[model samples]
Target chain A: MRILVLGAAGMVGRRLIDRLLAEGTIAGQAIDVIDAVDVIAAEIPATGRITIDVKASDVSDPDEITALIDKRPDIIFHLAAIVSGEAEADFEKGYRINQAGMSHLLEAIRAKGGNYRPRLVFTSSIAVFGAPFEEPIGDTFLMAPLTSYGTQKAICELLLNDYSRKGFVDGVGIRLPTIVVRPGKPNKAASSFFSGIIREPLAGQEAILPVADDVRHWVASPSAAIGFLMHAATMDTERLGARRCLTMPGLSVTIAEMIEALRMVAGDEVAGRIRREPDAVIEKIVAGWPRDFAADRALQAGFTADPDFASIIKAHIADEKQRVAQAGA
Target chain B: MRILVLGAAGMVGRRLIDRLLAEGTIAGQAIDVIDAVDVIAAEIPATGRITIDVKASDVSDPDEITALIDKRPDIIFHLAAIVSGEAEADFEKGYRINQAGMSHLLEAIRAKGGNYRPRLVFTSSIAVFGAPFEEPIGDTFLMAPLTSYGTQKAICELLLNDYSRKGFVDGVGIRLPTIVVRPGKPNKAASSFFSGIIREPLAGQEAILPVADDVRHWVASPSAAIGFLMHAATMDTERLGARRCLTMPGLSVTIAEMIEALRMVAGDEVAGRIRREPDAVIEKIVAGWPRDFAADRALQAGFTADPDFASIIKAHIADEKQRVAQAGA
Candidate 1:
């Protein structure tokens, strides 16, 4: 079946495109082709008969979004959003891209009516859950977002449910945890340090730890995130019903455990590259995030993840090695 | 303190306007005129230096919302929303007025920036909480809105919390229970029957009960809804912090209790006007709404309601008598 991936240039987006184009099947139907979009022109994965358009376009632009939808892809993976830091720092840009962009896309889909009811898989974030959280946050936790980015995501989730209920489209919003070992250069998100501490050190570079070791966070590897998205795109709607958003399963661990995992994967030498420089601002912000989460509903939905922290580290190491070898010679 | 009341032409809105102007004090605040708006010209509470503006303008228009904000009133009671049934019947109209209208007002407030950060009191609804709910839905219950109107309210609540957290504005969302003993002709709302059977019979008219007697619902009086708005406008936000939206204290009872209260207030002769006409469609929809709710947080914050169902019926009878006398004279 035809598939479209928005935010194709981003780390998770890139990985998802790779996975979908490489013999990915949903509900036993083979994915024939993939069309992807990014802010900058990039290469999209395409096989012999598959059509892949890797175009540069802003999702908030009505014409751009409409043009992408005109292809009438069977599934749309909406991964476009301003990172958390940029959203918090730039209010207008945050609302425009995050809220308006999603609104325009959903409206466009609804406008297509009868013949088109694409399965929409939107990548939301754990930021939807804010401070004073109950321990072991369930899939049904109330969204009391503390940031503009989170607020935008939460609002989109509501819209997805309403649209899905109206039979305008089949939608699923997957609230992913911080993707650890992101395997790339650091971005503008406050939580970028989450991946940086692992990724930078693995690449034989020093990375700063901005918060205390006791700071806990929920996280999943890139592979797991892609799996969550794929499962969401093909899952039985009868199980999800009108509540279309699901918090994907994640491992909740302290920063110290992350360092321990790093040591195991890349030896103590790589782990030694992490430098701690505490900042109360970052610490306070991190404190507001949930340390533990209960994703029982998502887990039961036939989506799986790395069983433990060690497996996540091993997967990252293996993936990074492949990237390293590809770059060499 | 200057107070602005959006949707002032609505039945509950007008009642609140009259009460605020007549009392000259709410939670110890002094006299103020009410700002009103609707399709038709509204008779606001007073006219003086308070500068009451009663205009016919669509609230969703950015320009109109901006003009309303120009006054920079100290307290803004935002009650303008398309009623549930109409909202459900017309999808685009629901999103335009309820969702987009709210966004326009909020964006206007945000645009004011440092110049104006008025206390915004938003009236939400019990529709935000849908079925399979815990017996007593607590403050932390997830928002599983079953209708378009409820989805809009839930979306607005997220924005309210984010804006408040960012210090852009002071905002509070109060999820009000269904207002009982309404003084009006029966409308199309599925929940209209909840009040109709009691309200019509008291007014010496026949009313149809479309659902089973066991169908439970959370309820508050018109006076309590007004109280919630006023309390929300004046309460200290430090306690609420990031969690700004609250489910206001309400009485949870079944239809049987509601009819009994009507019987006790106006005698069985008036109650005899009630007729049962069970509708499976309405019964199924009503079943998805939360029967009982726990508002411990709001109650602890000092917002209250009628102590029992008897008080609610008494208040309705008192209000209905005044209406009949005024119409006769």
Candidate 2:
């Protein structure tokens, strides 16, 4: 099976590509060609196992996506988006990239008729839901997004469902919880601190705790996100019916609990690196997010989450070690 | 206050225009100009009270709405749409009109800077909610529409909410229940039979009942829809916060209850003009619609519903008499 990965330069996208290359196959099919694309192509070296065509393609442009879809990749992984803070700050840029990008992609895929229905896995965010949520938000809660970015995701979810219903393409929209222990520097996402607090402290650096200790959030590991995407790509969607989007399973942990998990995994010295400097702006933004979810449908559909926060920390350390070893070699 | 009606030729639009002219003022503000536009221009006579400019404008086009927003109408009523059946048959046409129209309108309004924000009252549909619902679908139920038209409406609802949240526009989206006792012939809507059963029988003609008598539905009258729009236009949206959409209050009744009400209002002779020639296609389509709704939020916000089905029948009779009287004059 051939694959197309949009936003392949991003953390999750790069990891997914590395994982796919390592596996050499998906769902028992020998992977032949993988089109690794993004707004800016990254340094993806030659994997002698399969053909990796790395290129830069603007997903926001209709003609660009039309050309991409012309390649008829068997499975399309669409993970491109403008982060929440950037989208909320620059309205035009946000809609142009996040909203119009999805619209153009779906339209381009549909235009490729003749029953060219490829499995398209889209990464939607839990931001699609707003505040005053039901405890353990069920699979059927309304999407009253609090931010423009969330609204854009919610609209894309609707479009994806409709396009799938019309038989234009086989689609699955996974509403991923904020991925914790995100590698690299902090981005513009409001929830970036969820990762920074854990990632920075592990590197013997002081991390700013944006919210209070009592603040809780739904999160998953980077590996867990990749697992969700893989399952979404191969799962039987006949049971999904018209509702193609599902909230992926995630671990709900409070900031205090995360700190305790950090202490348990890497001792008090690393956990002590976190400073409790509450940011009112970040606190306000975090207040409108869902604390937990009853993602029963996703669990039933064979998606799994990290057992605990400690496992997440261990996994992140292992991933970091692997990256260092690769660089040393 | 200057007013602009996007779909001024349709049944509800025409009635809303007539009601606005009759009232002379909204929220204690006088209407100076009423720009009535639609895909096809209708003969809306000059009432000599307000300036009624009737013209044809395709809402799907961005440039046209940009020009419409240039007028700076204080209150804009956007009830334009591609009906469910047509949207289901032609996917491109549906998204182009319903989804693109709302997007373009919001963009145009946002583009008109200098703090120009107009009150945009949009007509959404109950079709936004799909089947297997809670006994009475609440305001916060997820939008997993079964049809393409519902998908488009649901998407538009998200856009409206986001734009409103961003302070680009002051928008209120009212999810109207099925309008019963409709004064015209049945159209392409799967729920058209709900009105046809009441309307054709009152017109001394037979109407087809395509579903079981026990099948329940949420419904309101023509005047109730107008009331919802007027209230939406004037209602203080400060309390709405980020969620600018609400399910309008409506009476829940089955076909048997409707027929009983008709018999009480117009006698068995008029009600007996009913045929039970069930159409399987329409039955399956209607099965996926919302049967009832709590609509507590809208009620709390001062929106009212018809007291009962008998009142709906009585109102239709009164409206018909008024129409005949106007024609005679």
Candidate 1's residue-wise lDDT over B265-325, tens digit each?
7898988898898899998878777888889999999899789888998888888788789
Query: What does candidate 2's lDDT look like per residue over B247-319, in tens digits?
Result: 9999999999999999999898998999999789878877777888999999999999999999999999899
Q: What share of the true interface contacts does each candidate keep?
A: 0.89, 0.95
- Model 2 residue A113 lDDT score: 91
Sequence-dependent TM-score of model 1? 0.95
What is the alpha-carbon lDDT of model 2 when measured against the actual structure? 0.91
User: Candidate 2, residues A4-101: lDDT per residue as tens digits?
Assistant: 99999998999899889999989889999999999998668787879998989888889989988999999999999878888999999999999899
TM-scores of the models, in the order given? 0.95, 0.98
- State the C-alpha RMSD over the true interface residues for candidate 1, after superposing those residues: 0.8
* Interface DockQ per candidate: 0.85, 0.91
Off by over 4 Å in 1: A24-27, A30-32, A44-49, B25-32, B44-51
Q: Can you tell me which runs of candidate 2 are displaced by over 4 Å?
A: none
CAPRI-style class, candidate 2: high
How big is the positional error of residue B271 in model 2, measured in Å on the Cα after superposition?
2.6
